[model samples]
Target: MDTLNSKKVTRRSFLKGAALLASIAVVPAAITSKDASAAAKATQAAMQYQDHPKGKLECSNCIQYIPGKTAKAKGTCKVVEGAISPQGYCLAYAPKA
Candidate 1:
């Protein structure tokens, strides 16, 4: 009978492997999630980002708007620099699904 057990995984080794995989999975997600907001934001003037709505269009309703602490509070935009009004409109606006 052969008793060579070279592949045995100890608790410490198992935990290390699990933690390595967990970190591998988490890092990609963190990087991807930031892809949208990490890019250099466009100047508000360049995007025609206004403090008021453009008819029915507005920042809160756009996909690029990052909400503030409150419903009506000013927020930031993924595509524009500086604080943004919830009612603001921009040329870069894309309706959220």
Candidate 2:
């Protein structure tokens, strides 16, 4: 009886561990898929910054723009990577509504 009980416990533990690993593997794939989708959208939008802006359009007024932590400094954009300037203009620009 004792031997049978121990074997059942071992199998249950193994199954639990396998289930945990499977869940961990699935979470990253979901996150990666979301990131890939965002990248695709950015590409479709033709996201790019211009040194000389086309008009009054700038990162500061774009919906994707994220203001810098401090004043008078470059900020960031949701679609564009790297440090972005508030005065910078990009093809992905969408007016803040």
Candidate 3:
């Protein structure tokens, strides 16, 4: 009777499997949950609020107005330099003052 008794798993293989499992477990979190979406929508609504039919909130009035702190990864507006509010309705509405 011959039996295979010494088939051990390598460290590399174990590490790879562990990493794969870890990534799989975190994929859902990384894929933007419902709460995250709601927050994003709220922010968007906050910044989209214009005074008139052809006006804008700009960044000076935004609650989240972080001058020199906003970026492409923050929101959709390219005029402001920081993360302005979506419903941020301001009087000035300057470009980036």
Clashes of each: 0, 0, 9
In model 2, which regions exceed 4 Å deviation?
1-15, 30-48
Highest-scoring model, lDDT = 1
Clashing residue pairs found in predicted model 1: none
**Candidate 1 lDDT tens digits, 19-61:** 9999999988998878866667899899988899999999999
Q: Which pairs in model 3 have colliding backbones?
A: 45-87, 46-86, 46-87, 46-88, 47-85, 47-86, 47-87, 48-86, 70-82
Q: Distance (Å) between predicted and true CA of 8, model 3?
A: 1.3
Please tell me which predicted candidate would have the highest TM-score against the true structure. Answer: 2
lDDT (Cα, tens digit) per residue for candidate 2, span 1-97:
8886776547889999999999999999999999886665353125667644568887888899899987558887788876788888888889999
Tens-place lDDT digits, model 3, residues 29-58 = 977685565454343334454423344444
Model 3: residues >4 Å from true position, as ranges? 1-6, 33-40, 43-50, 53-60, 65-97
**Candidate with more favorable, higher lDDT: 1 or 3:** 1
* CA lDDT of every candidate: 0.90, 0.78, 0.49
